[model samples]
Target: MPYTAEISRVNPSCFLFLIDQSGSMSDLFPEVGCSKAQGLADAVNRLLQTLATRCAKGEEVRDYFDVGVIGYGQNIGPVLQGPLAGRDLVSISEIAFNPAKLETKIRKVPDGAGGLVEQNFQLPIWLDPVHNGGTPMCEALRRAKSLLEGWVVAHPTSYPPTVIHITDGESTDGDPSIDFQKKILAG
Candidate 1:
C-alpha cells in the first residue's frame, strides 16, 4: 500500500520554494499584463496564506509544515522578508504570524447581470519582486538538497519534502540535472 501518513503537528511535512530572480523575470507576462516576478511573488504569497489557513486550529496555527523560499540570482539564499528574513526553514505558525505587509488589491468578478464587477480584498505579502543577475539554478538546487537533507535526518518518519521550482529561463550557471539526479533524487 502507498504511504498514508497524516500530516499533523507531530508528523509534519516541508515545502521548499525555489524562485528564479534573474533579470529575465522582469519581462512582462503578456497574459497577466505584469512582470513575471510580480506574478510569481503574488502566487507564492497566496500559497503561503493558504497553507497557514489549512494549519489553523482554534486560536493557534499548528506546526504542520516547515516552509522555505530560496531565490536564485545575484544572491542564492532565503528570500522571505519580515521576521522570516535570513532564515532558511521555519514552522507554519511563524509564517502565519509574520507577514511582511498587507496590501489591498482589486479583482474582477462576474455579477449576476453578466457584467464584471470590481472587488477589493486584502492580501498578505511576504515576498516582493526581485530581478537581477544570472539564473543560478544549479546552485539553488544544490542549496535545496542541503536543506532538505538536514530536514529528512531530523524528521525521518515524516512525509517527504516537496520542492516547487519556478524559473523563467534556463540555468546560466551549469547543468542542474546532474546535481538534481546525483544529490536530490539519489535518496
Candidate 2:
C-alpha cells in the first residue's frame, strides 16, 4: 500500500490550475453575478496567495510548492498574462509576487447596528476575460500532459502534482476522450 507523504519544505507538492477561457466562459453566471472568467481568475489568485502564506517562514516565504495556471481558449497553452507570461510551473513565492493587478471591490458586510457596511477587498487578477473561438480541449490536455511529464521527471520522489481542471463543457477541436489521455500519456 502507498502511504500518504508529508508536505514539507524539502519535499513539497504542486498545484496546476487548468482554466477554460473559451467563448462560453464569457457568459454571466447567475449564481456569482459575474462572468465565469472573473470567478476563475479570482479563485486561482486566492489559491496562489494562500499557498504562499502557508509556506512562509519568518520574513521570507519558502518555495515549498510549484504552482501553475493554464488558460486555454483561442489558442491552447499556458496562460501568457501578467508576470506569469511565458512561464510554467513557477514557485509559490513567484506566484505571490506576480499578480497582474490588484483591484478593490466594495462589498456589503453586516454591521453591529443591523445594517450593511461597505468593505473594500483587494482582488488580484492574472488573466482577463477573453472570449474567443474554439474550445480545443485536446490541445489543452496535451499541453498539460507535457508539463506534468516534465515535472514528474524533475521531481521523481515528490508527490504527484494535483491538476484542477475547469472547463465550460465545449470542445471544438476534438473530444478530450480517454483515447486522448492514452495518446498523450503513451507518447
Candidate 3:
C-alpha cells in the first residue's frame, strides 16, 4: 500500500499555498490557538507529509501537481515553498530552525509507535499587529499567479490546480481577489 499507488492512474494535481503574512496575522486564530503564521506552517507541513506519501507510491509529485508556497505580510518568506517532490518541501530541521514570520510554533511529540507526532503551538515568526496600514495580499496573489502559470503550462490537462490563499485581514493591495480568481479560472 504505497502512498502513490492509489492515485497513480489519476491526473496529477498542483497545489499552490498562497499564505497571507500580513501583520494582523499575529493575533490568535481559534483553529490554531496561535499566531496565523505558526498555524499555517504546521498545516502546510502536514499537507506536504500527506502528499509525500502519495508521491513515494509513484504519484508524479512534479509532473502531476507542482507544489509551491508563497508567503506575504511583514516578511513573507517562501521557506516551505517548492515542488511536491521530497526535495522541494522544507526539511523538518528547517521547520525547526527558521520558520516563516507568519507561522505558528510546532513540536514533534512521540507517536507512541516509535514515531512522533507534530504538535502545533502558538508562536509566530513574522506578524505585525498593526491596527491599520498596508497588507501585501495582492502581491502574494500576483506571485501565485506567476507560479501557477508555469505549472499549468506543463500540466495543462492535469487536474485543476489548487491555489489556496490564506489571509486574515482585508487586502491593502486593493481588489485583487476577483482578478486573481479570473486568472486561476483562465489557467
Candidate 4:
C-alpha cells in the first residue's frame, strides 16, 4: 500500500518594498499616524517583526521568503538589504530607527564590557510635500526592478516575487511606470 505524508508547500517568496520618500508623501495621512515617513517606518517594522516570528517557527518566512526593503526620499537616495539572508538578520525596529540622516549629535554609551559605543543612527529626513520638489518614484522603481530581476535570476527555484509599491503622488517623470512595469515583468 502506498501512503502520503503531509508536507508544507510554502515555497520561497521575495518581496520588494518600494517606498516613495518624495516630497508629496510628507502630506498628512490619517491612517499612518504622524507623517507618511513615520507611517512607512511603522508599517515596515511591523511587517518585518511578523515575518521574523513566522520564520522562527519554521514557517514560510525564512524557509520560503526573502524581504528586500528599499527607501527613496530626501537626499539619502536608497537603502537596500536582504532580511532573512542570514541568521543575524537585521530587525525591522533597527531599520525603522536607522534613517539616512543624523537627527541629533552622535551619542556614546558605555557597552558595559569595558568599551564605549558610539551610536550613529539618525532620524531620517522626512519627505516633505513642498520642500523636496518633484518625486523621483520612477528611479526608485527602476532600482527595485533591477534588484528583483537579480534576485529572481539567482533564485530560479524560489517562488514568485511580490513587489509592494507605495506612493503618495503620481510620477513626475511622465508615465515611466508602464515602461518600468514592462521591464520588470519581462525579467
Candidate 1, 123-168: lDDT as tens digits: 9998999999999999898899899999999998898999999998
TM-score of each: 0.93, 0.87, 0.58, 0.59
Clashes of each: 0, 0, 15, 3
C-alpha positional error of residue 166 in candidate 4 after TM-score superposition, expressed in Å: 0.7
The model with the greater lDDT, 1 or 4, is 1
Q: Evaluate all candidate structures by whole-model CA lDDT and list the values in order.
A: 0.93, 0.79, 0.57, 0.56
Q: Global lDDT for candidate 1?
A: 0.93
Q: Residue 44, candidate 3: how far off, in angstroms?
A: 1.3
Model 3 — TM-score against the truth? 0.58
* Sort by TM-score, top down from the best: 1, 2, 4, 3
lDDT of 4: 0.56
**Model 1 TM-score (2 dp):** 0.93
In model 3, the Cα lDDT at residue 3 comes to 34
Please write out the lDDT profile of model 3 over residues 30-88, one tens digit for every residue. 86577665676656666654655455434333333455666676644464522212222
Least accurate stretch of 10 residues (summed lDDT) in model 1?
Answer: 178-187
Point out the higher-scoring one by lDDT: 2 or 3.
2
lDDT by residue (tens digit), candidate 2, 17-132: 88888888888889879988777777777777688888887878888788887878887666736878878788887777777888887889999899999999987666666666
